[model samples]
Target: MTELRHRGPAETDLQAADDFRGLDKDGAPDGDAHSDSEAKGDTGLPDVPVPPDDTPQVLNKALSGLSSRWKNWWVRGILTLAMISFFFFIIYLGPMVLMMIVLCVQIKCFQEIITIGYSVYHSYHLPWFRTLSWYFLLCVNYFFYGETVTDYFFTLVQREEPLRILSKYHRFISFALYLTGFCMFVLSLVKKHYRLQFYMFGWTHVTLLIVVTQSHLIIHNLFEGMIWFIVPISCVICNDIMAYMFGFFFGRTPLIKLSPKKTWEGFVGGFFSTVVFGILLSYVMAGYRYFVCPVEFNSDSNSFTVDCQPSELFQLQEYPLPAVLQSLTGWATVHMYPFQIHSIALSAFASIVGPFGGFFASGFKRAFKIKDFANTIPGHGGIMDRFDCQYLMATFVNVYIASFIRGPNPSKVIQQLLALRLDQQLQIFNSLKAHLTERGLLPANEVAA
Candidate 1:
């Protein structure tokens, strides 16, 4: 009985040791299996964790531990709302502030793009690249801004003797400045890095073409009318937001390889939502002269004004309905703003073509293997990232204006005439009178005067 008892205790100890070892082995595999399942779940989507540098100051590290999806939504929503609020505030502040904002955005975008080029070509140690890029930017800005000032604020230009002289020789001065930069770039080129220097030269010029030129067009749109800027921009913003909302909920089929998360469902949903939003926003803005009137400097007020009579595009007009629609709705006509009709075109472009701009940026970034252009805006990548579609929309608006909306500016013509030499002005005046007389548009008495 004593021997049996001793054997039983030893058997129990052996069994306990085996169980302990088994638990260690089995537990390890179980943990590994759970991790494998998680990795499998995340196979398609990239692990885009927020970098330490890009994280917001408001968000504590503890909050950063939240799931990526939640963090994205939180950051995106907060920034979007803040941006919208700031947009309205700027609008209320008036056109001057808006112009300043556009200028700042342009400079920032230029910096971001130039910085990219610097980083990419840094290996070659190209000399004076950054300086040449900035010099070119300055040259371009001077040329464009001078033209804009001469065109839109002729009164102010004429009142100031220095500005008048500058405006008179603006193009020549701009050319001289650009030539100087070109000479400097050429002088700075080293024999060893000639190819690298030339490559960077092309890069700088292309970046200027994309960033500066498009931004100049945006300024033109803003001057034509606030509506030209606000409506198109709002359409893009609405589309971007709705696309995300739709995609988050119902996205399945990938839209493009460049942007895998983009889906056909989101694209379609954004289109309809943007169209509706554009039309409604246009309708409301049409009623406000502040939104519809072209920006003009007022010497008397010593400030800019949006006080001109609203253009025909902003006017309300009634159109007779088709017979089928009239029968169905019992209405013979519908009143609508022509600008609202144009908004459809704007929204359509913003919806259809605008996203391509974003895709192109995405492809460019992927080529460089960079996540975002710069961490300018939290959760939104950078200013360049947000404004990619906007730049495209701005170009469209400028083209549309030139094609359909722009008319001969009497003030601009008069300013040009006034800038001429006295003899030249008199000769042109006489020629105009003679032409008018031949057409029987000028009375003999007025012609003599």
Candidate 2:
């Protein structure tokens, strides 16, 4: 009261005025604005406010001493070696474990992508979107798993009556389950958020297309042979590491705008390194039946075995050298695995085209104004981040195998035969018998029997 005679306002009133001035025109505090700033800070965005020097340690002292770029490279190298070792261990463990790993990776990737959608569209409070997303994932998985089981384990499925029934109407059942989820989604849509709901629907489908579809192809590649799964993946890993190393040491010209750190130097270095690594790895893997042979169910052992005679693709052959090389090398041809030739294509794509997948992911992150997909892999971002290029590579390998490598699968044909009705089966059996008899491929007694 002694000094209030001349004071314009009390301290509390001045503080309230400052707070009011900080708010938006709607009179609500700009909490979202501050939240964004904090998120940027957490993600290490350059413009965000940095913590004070007195702030407590967040990272380990050993890691904290290194610059961010060095820390990223160091962490990536360690993770890469660990992952490579883990992959070999899984391969040794068998196809079932490898299939489970693929499934786990697919689920994690789908989760990361769908989580992004939820974050972006969360304010609209779209009903049943998450449920519908997971439901569709389940439905698609059922459809894919059913197809896989029918193709690879038809005998096992037929031995069990319940499984045989389920296998018969698998597609119809999957459709029905998906339709139920679709109906629930439709019923949950709010009138006010109709546009947002539809937008999220598209988002969910796109995510499925990108993540689940590619992952399914990866599984198909795995079943084709461990080489199909391993070589391409290893090539990609080699390219990634070599590219990073080259870029860190001598990157000058930028390769792409989306990923600023990518350099032409890195790209070229990675390509050569990947091709060499792929060929060498293919040579080594081709020697082992475990890597070169397709996975097949062994009913006697009740376990999968990679015991088929190695395909011509996996066998060593002498490829004739070109005129110029023949003169220089004093050799007409070089002995090498045919699979090694295919590995070149795989490695080339991993270098040339696979990077686009990473760029696409980068652009997506930029559009969303986020740093990493998620902090799922420390310093490496998410599993999605690591596998983005791998997925693209997997799709290419699957297509390549279908186009140039794969022949009619005998087991798949048997599965189709088993699916036929009794009348249809007899018709095919008689027609085949007649054709074989006419061609003199079957004995008269055998045909009659």
Best prediction by lDDT: 1
Off by over 4 Å in 1: 1-53, 60-66, 421-429, 442-449
Candidate 1 lDDT over 197-281, as tens digits, reads 6767888899989988998898999999899999999999999999998998899989998898999999999999999999999
TM-score of every prediction relative to native:
0.84, 0.84
lDDT of each: 0.83, 0.79
Off by over 4 Å in 2: 1-59, 418-426, 437-449
Would you give me the overall lDDT of model 2?
A: 0.79
Q: How accurate locally is residue 231 in candidate 2, as Cα lDDT from 0 to 100? A: 92
Report model 1's TM-score to 2 decimal places. Answer: 0.84
Return the TM-score for candidate 2, rounded to 2 decimals. 0.84
